[model samples]
Target: MSKDDDTTQYDGAAGGWGSVRGMLSTFREEADSPAVLRTLMRQNKPGGFMCTSCAWTKPAHPHPFEFCENGAKATLWELTSHRCTPDFFAAHTVGELKGWTDHDLERQGRLTHPMRYDAASDRYLPCSWEDAFEEIGAELAALDPRTAVFYASGHASLETAYLYALFARLYGHNNLPDSSNMCHETTSVALKAVIGAPVGTVAPDDFGQCDAIFFFGQNTGSNSPRFLHTLQECARRGVRIVTFNPVREKGLEVFVNPQHPHEMLTGDGTRISCQYHQVTAGGDIAAMLGLCKHLIAEDDRLRADGRPGVLDHGFIAEHTIGFAEFAAMARNTTWEAIEAASGLARAALLDAAGVYMAAERTIGIYGMGLTQHVHGFENVAGFVNLLLLKGNIGRPGAGISPVRGHSNVQGQRTVGITEKPELAPMDKYRELFGFEPPGETGMNTVDACEGILAGRVKAFVGLGGNFLRAIPEQAAMEQAWTALRLTVQIATKLNRSHLINGRVAFLLPCRGRAEEDVQESGPQTVTMEDSLSRIHGSFSTHEPASPHLLSELAIVAGLAKATLPPNPKVRWDDWTADYAAVRDLIEATYPDQFKDFNKRVFTPGGFHRRNTARDRIWKTGSGKAVFTTPTMLSATSIADAPGRYRLITLRSNDQFNTTIYGYSDRLRGIEGRRNVLLINPRDIERAGLADGQVVALESDAGDGTHREVAGLMVTPFDLPDGCLAGYYPELNPLVPLWLHDIHSKTPASKAVPVRIRS
Candidate 1:
């Protein structure tokens, strides 16, 4: 465990006393305030509000302290004592605030009231909620509804997102964009096409039954700490864990279950990953294909032995189609091609294949690493193909697990927040609302930016999220925002997006997950669906962070009322009075699955929602699981330009998405800085660069669009050759708007071709 020049020591294990120390510091600095402590104490507890961190599922039987380090940070962030009132905005001009980093803007704390940009003074001034709504309504009503872009964040509850989508459609537009369009759209695209569902089918309980688990491209420790407990349990039970990623994540190496006091105090933790391999950037597809090839060869060998071969022929024949074509393609694949692309020795893949062959049941866990490439959809297919060959789907202890971001990203999609509205859902809407929904496909995140730059999008409405910060091609996105006639953000706190104004800009403060939302009917509770498809209610016991702030659901209702004319079928007032009314509508729309939605969601641990894939029922044109034959590409195929290195954007251990909790990445041992790029030692030497040397990165965007970020300190680390990693938002510029996956349209953030210079 040697320390790099930047003091980034190779972390042997994740989460010991250091995690406890970070938790305590977060409590003191961010959550020690009166309201914050009261709210934090009740958060993630039974019957309390769900933590607004990553969508890691909660245990059915919760302990007293159910939160983790990042979870606590998210809670403190939402319930922080600091407030940004009118006076704070009045003192700082937009020009001055524009220079501030995203970390500094959010650290100032919760937004207390609605505000509007005062063009005359270049500062934001307090505006009444009523006047703010009226101004937005007037602007939106004046513009062509098709030109209005509606953006959604995963921070909102199912009720809020469902309501927001309904309002946007009722306003006569379906330009709905969401965070998933950037992160997991590829997973959705692949899953829907292959398995007939947009979500995962595996529940947390299945971890206990799994014999082997494959970590395709996920950092479970930092992104999802609670899941590590299950990993530790599997480790104790002698389950095999194989990881395929470009970075040597500490979590995948070893982990200390914080729930276990012995491991926390003694610094002795369960060793998690039995075997770890670093794939080249965008190399997951090749690595997975290599594994599949080895499995096929092993099956052929066992079949010759007159024994039970690894191939589940019975299941494949009865439950799937097109396998013969896939097997032919997989057998034709060469070992040299896979080794060169995956950056792993043939022996390693063969060893991992042996482990897979020995196990009776297995699961493949993946994150953005597998889904943020040009062939991301194909990468997903590769993993699923391996599992399908072994009969993993629709069985206990097996299936695809997409570790999702945002507490309710899955829930929002389930409640019908989508750009591609289908005919069936449209029919349901017409039956309920007495109006026909839009028929054409709408803009996604990247498409919305295209709409903006083309001068087709006039007004932008965001439910919650730092849209301006999260998107790729930041410089272009900012230009697009400036050209828009109107921009409105409904959010809990102030962010840099508010400063990236349009011709007219307004900020509507709303209640966060940790605050109570009192409605006309009574104190209301909202539901959040976890990554496992469990729908559960979350009620905040603490009072609102500020009385001036309204609930997100209420904001959506208010916007609907202010903008849309009354319809006898759609009752905005009734939906706002009681959230249950919204649930009723959702259940009535998706009756087969969401039947008794309100009652089921309130059940202890929340009832698991039905996914057709879980029952081995394929709703596709094939009427069965369809094997996909994808042409495998080189790992660095996207980095085609000469002297170009593939840049993979990442979030530090201290950060979540664009929210900077602090300047440290505990697992990587980085401290007090975000202006550094991680590079392989040999790669740095080849580029004629020394450790700690300042350098610049230039995008391979041959298009007229210029993209680069300079003044970054280079630090040598263990990584795939010709591949570099850096924190996101800083490196997002290198990913041009035009560079994306052709299938899913997701930003190819993981493998943007870039040149490093002195």
Candidate 2:
């Protein structure tokens, strides 16, 4: 129980009263009151707004208590009574707050007013919302719209993002970078190339019908606590679960449900993973190929033995293309090559494949672990190849699910928040808004970084996320981002991004998901699309966190009114006041998918958006599932560099993306600090480092130019032999922006080659 000790064993189940204690402690930290208590009770309730945590979908059949431990923590954090007022900023300069930890900055409390950086004062001075909007408008009006970047966070409501996207397009620029560009852009591209859709094929209820589940790369228990409950349910219903990750996370091993009386009282939990394989960092593609190869061999053996074959040849012939070529390519991938690339045994892969062979209905779930690589598309396509082999998709319980990070990251893209602007949306914009939309491909998250550094993108406007901290190579990214003339952030709280100001920086405070967003028309509910492609409505319970705050939709509308040329056709004020009108525009934009969006979104579990891929319809170029046989495993491993190790960034139990809720990582058993790196005992011994040796980790990304983080105390744990792990933002410096996926342009944060300097 020592605050600084890194000796806690990874033995306890994820939940129990530990969850309750954590929840209560977090609530207390938030200055919880009767209002907070009532708001907490309303969370996940029928007809209530959604939790702003992870994107685990709402159940079709609503439960009395549907939220999880982490969800409660997120809610409490957002609803914290403390406010970061204008006086607080006046008391502390931006230069002084620069030294504060990301955790400390967020804990300072909710932002209460609009503020802009004052060069002479060396601080953020309170500014009127209208004045702030006018400043942003003047900047945009002076510059070519293509030179400006408008980024969206994943938590953006569909209504909010629709308006934001409209504003960007109407302003004649598609330089829109979103959080999804960093996380799931590869998931979208790969699925479209292989399975013919960017979304998961399985519904939440499909957990009941799945006979086996393969978890690749993601730590489900910590990242999405509610999803672990789904896994627990699947396990209880006799689903064989196998996980492949570089580290053996506690959540994947054992999970104790706090809601279950027996487990909570007895201090017992359900054993989660039937078999867990510690795949090497940047090795998911090779390992995935290995699994498919073994499956093919097993299918051959079954056919040779005159038993019913494991290969779904009939399904393959009818529903897919390129099987013969893909099968040949898969078999050509030798065990030695796979072992060298993946650091996994041929036998272990065969054993995992055996489970796949036994179960007719299987679901494959993956996360950033697989998608944040140079060959992310290949890694994802490989997973789909494994699923397509058995005709797993288009079935009740069997499919591929890429667990999205944010509550509305998937929804944002569905409603046209994309860098690669589509013609359909352009046509809709022209037809509805009386403006010609831009057709050029715009800057993504990575492109924006390069664009700013190259002096192309002069202005950046962040809709929600901490763009600076979330991206890779923080030092370089900071200089590149802060160099912009105009940087505007529409957010709920003060984060590091706010401190990393530009020449003319403005922080426009916006309402959080937990608070009621009242407009001139009245209290408005926003629409969100969860991970499972279900459209849902979330109505706020607690009043606005600050009287000065505005809804994301209103902010966008205000910006649009200030920036766009006034035309009779564009009803900016009308759309902002009536959010339902925003939804109407969204429905009109995508008529078939968002049909009657307003009526259906307020229902019990909301409405399931139409996924043609789930109905055995292929939307790809081939009009069938296409197999992408990986020609090579290109994700870099630090094996060649003698003193270097493959470093992968992760979120602590208390952290969600760039928002540091606390220093403690309860699930991983670390506390009170974020400066430790988790290395295997074997790696520690090989590096000539002791258990608690203080060291510096330098990136091997750039051409011999050092990018190092010092004072990192090594903590030996159950990580892969040549692997290392550190919490994100701290380790973001070690991840180079150039080291990204070629197709999707996602930063390779999960696989950074770094050397430990003691």
Candidate 3:
């Protein structure tokens, strides 16, 4: 590969020398302290801070290096010496800063002081914390509770989330929308309806007990590289691995363990997946229907021959309902529709089904790929249907695992950062805090943006996130953001969202997870819950980025104290001084889930939260796991037209959710740019376009909106003919705010209809 060429073929295994180079380069470029490597060694250990990257679990018997490449990058990125101080803000105006790129804005580094946007000067000037809080309090007090939106991100800890949730409820309404509403809300919605639990059922040790593992829509190498170690161990033990994704991922094919001496010395890696099927975008339901149909048909044949069939008939009869209706729908779905929708032959699905039938125990893992679509709820139900057929639930080595992003995302939701009225304990809140809670449901992410645009929402408060940059309709939302009367952002670093100011905006700097947090209680540790429902304490030994920075706990407490009149039931000062007071409140609210929360969280390896679904006890109205049927084979029904393709928004190996680490996507062999479009070679030839030609993409939503992005370089890759891939936030404009899942309201970022023009 040369500097002129932006794309190249990466033939090496994922997580060998390539990962080593990536980690070292990040450290060399970002680290200010010579002891950064020693700091990295403490990550995920018993008394160390949790890696702030993903929700991947730590092993009971930990290895010397438990962290992954992304974890190292997150640590170094947080601990960088570069500072976005008051001087930097003083030099740049809001209009001038908006012209800069997202990467460059964050590259200016950690925000050191609290700043307020000045309309006259059009620049952010430093302000005292008390004055800033007082102004926000006055603005919020003047507005109706229903008109204010309180948003939270996945980065907040359990203690902070618990306090934040209470703060909003105490003020008035439940307009609490968090990051979970965007990514895995589909999984939570569908799983709760079918299995009576909103979270996954598998534990870490289940990987070793399963005879086979099925992966859907998840990219293990980039999103959660720590999972690659488990996959490598399973592959070495002859566990059959099957994968279904739109793009062929290297992490699922093979992985080289950097920690293993033999592999690092000899450059030998273990072969991972036995079968990989490239399912088309929005085709997961059809593919899953194909698998279910095959297994049911095979069972009928075996039962007629008077032998034991593959279906778990006894389990179905004893513990499930709606089996006949669900099976009928699966059988009614024709193979032709499945083939066209999934872009896979009947033989491929049959082969994967055969692996599932032969195994006594299996685990299914998925990521945002299946959940960020219009019919994402149906896609999740399809996965549960496959697992239910073999009695895979509530058994050893068999369950569903929704690999999540952000360390405490699931934990935040567990502690109650939701918009639904039923999910919150309104009566308990009244009893505990001596206030009557609002009974009406509140706004989600999509609804919040619509509210802001419609002038119904007057204020916005963000705990920690780039809300404008992470959502769809980026240009429209950024423009509409100025309509709000107040905007308060509590953050550690400067992102593009800081530039999109409202009439009165305040940016309050907070402590990062990698920095030590000391309260009146001396030292404090926050808790995080992984994808497996295990709770653990996380603490850092490093100094704060700035001496003026406050903890997230203190910031939330301060805001609550300033906003509302003093109430006898609430003790904001006491809770802020000691986090255990907050934990005691949490345990009292969800007694079964967080019993003895403070004592158990600090112990080695932490504790596992109770999930009744793991014990075959469904918490639904039926008291048993239910089955669901899918009505549609595809998510969208755009008229088939020439040059039409489904555009999938992707994250590079150098990127996290909305944070761009660098310009290079090392795993895909792309360098120095992110404005390149990945298209099939056949599609490029059919469209009469050359490999390196500049092209544009126009979205087709049938809503009379003209959405197009130009100046994209076309690069040929191996994929289905009518599918294209590009990075997110860059491609967010092509998706409309109204295009989302009907049930979950999650923006459909995975599948957008578009046409390519050269």
Candidate 4:
């Protein structure tokens, strides 16, 4: 049968639950159960390892098992028993491997040795570490450093990211493209513009004191389950929780803590949200504007009645500027425009605003859903605007929290895995290495993809990440990757990035965070910065899977040493031998934050970094929380013709970011399939479609391309009108590479216009 036919047949015969059961059964067979349990126990413990999954902060207080479901799966995937040896590669040609699914490619398991692709044999052959490093060095040295791009994943520890950045600058390239560019770029850009730092203001303990919590575009339940515990506690304390998202997630509705013996025994779950409003895609800025306007009106009423205003007028005058301009803009925005754009009734917005204004303490939390839009930066600004109005910052139970994905993404940025131009970091490199660092602006993830496609990027070296699968515009990324002269990936397992071969491609096997790394100094511990901007130490207890495998730091240092002549001023070997030295250097570079890094990290629960926003201090040029007036009030409709639906990409409960742990999205009732599109019952009827029908969705922007998914089980859902949802990576092909936030360059992964046909 044809691929389309197979998809249709599978959808009809295998019910969603059946498919889920089958996949779970397979996962059980494939998973290394004992190793998973062992690895999970190590997470967030003193001298234990860090989670390799999302960047959700480990609790200030440690748990017996800090591993969430996705975290456990990540650990298992890393410590899999399967191995991809040279002999296995000999049997499978590169051409044949290219035809395999993403699941199949990763299922080949851990890379056993350093291997280089042989075009003549159409396979990868084993090569010695020294030979591989020499070839990599030779290729890198031949190219102008400006043309080379260095990419990092959030999985890289603080030590590895520091080394990666140092190596790139020493090699005279500032092109440090990172995973953050794709996910939380808007948070970084907007927060930095308003505050001196790019991190959130609140720590985990602040949740306990919050009277109200407002979340925009964040799915805390599936994305970060541990947060549910805090939310539950807040609910029990009569704290109000509100959400604004296109879809109502199960986790947000209610959660039964399996850890709570009483709750689990009774099968009782805590009711989460006091109010849940379905905001339209790209409508966050409008909703926020409406709230600000309502606050102003309420304040006027209070003043007219000889009562104190709802706002912290004293704080605003003392700590901020530009309030007049911001208040004017909010007051001027018409209720009609706000209602139409947000698809929220004025009454609903006012209700939410009233609750926010009445609260003694409020916390604003958000995720990628808010950042992956055209007006993402504006959305963040609006959140800050509300916080500033109420003086809800710097105190317990109040602040902004951007829920970042990945274990060490924040740490990577903390240590300089950024494309943002920094003179101090560059100067430090020059002073330490006795060479001038590149001062030119570097490429971001999007720019890197474009450069490679245009043949401007000669070499691609990824420290650790599935770049091919994670990046949007799959075709362009694939083409660019295949066209490179040399590509080197230092990773623990086989991934799609390794499949896209260049003229000379090398895959270097590396040790995972779960494994011990003993060097001349002793058993070493690496530090990671959590989502709350707290840094903690992690040490591995398990033995390395293979003695041949090198640490990510060792591999990076070897490559740098091979590529550059020995510089006695910089002790590369010393840093590699001892991770503490790396931390010392990090402390030296950023003394304002990491003073006495080793001593501070040793403190129980680690240390919280400086948060200027907590003090309501605006670090913008005008020293105020500037309210930005958007040039466009709403996103331009991509639908030129009728019957077009806005497609929002989503991740399943079984998935974490780009990594697919399993095929089932338990809450959504999707199983053994990432191809199905989720449509509301109303939308299905409006489109003259029935349940379990095959359909094709075509991009409305004249891309002239269509994707077919069959057996879609139409179910009624609380999603916005004219909006549909589907899984990402699979749907990534539809989002154009150039379609992104203008300022932050984050792909518009959440909002894409498309039309469905039966």
The best candidate in terms of lDDT: 3
Q: What is the clash count for each candidate, in the order shown?
A: 0, 2, 0, 2
Every candidate's lDDT: 0.84, 0.85, 0.88, 0.79
**Given candidate 4, what's the lDDT at residue 496?**
76
RMSD of candidate 3 to the true fold? 1.7
Candidate 3 displacement at residue 546 in angstroms: 0.5
Candidate 4 residue-wise lDDT, 346-418, digit = tens: 9999989978988989999999878887767887877888888888866788988999988888889888787
| Candidate 4 lDDT | 0.79
List candidate 1 stretches off by more than 4 Å.
Answer: 1-7, 635-642
Clash list (residue pairs), candidate 1: none
TM-score rank order: 3, 1, 2, 4
- TM-score per candidate: 0.98, 0.97, 0.98, 0.94
Residue pairs that clash (backbone atoms under 3 angstroms), model 4: 54-406, 55-406
Angstrom error of the Cα, residue 91, model 3: value is: 1.2
Pick by lDDT: 3 or 4, better one: 3
Whole-structure CA lDDT of model 2: 0.85
Report the lDDT tens digits of candidate 2 across residue range 288-372: 8888888887788888999877889999999999888888988887899998888889889888888988998999999999889
TM-score of 4: 0.94
- CA RMSD for every model? 1.6, 1.8, 1.7, 4.2
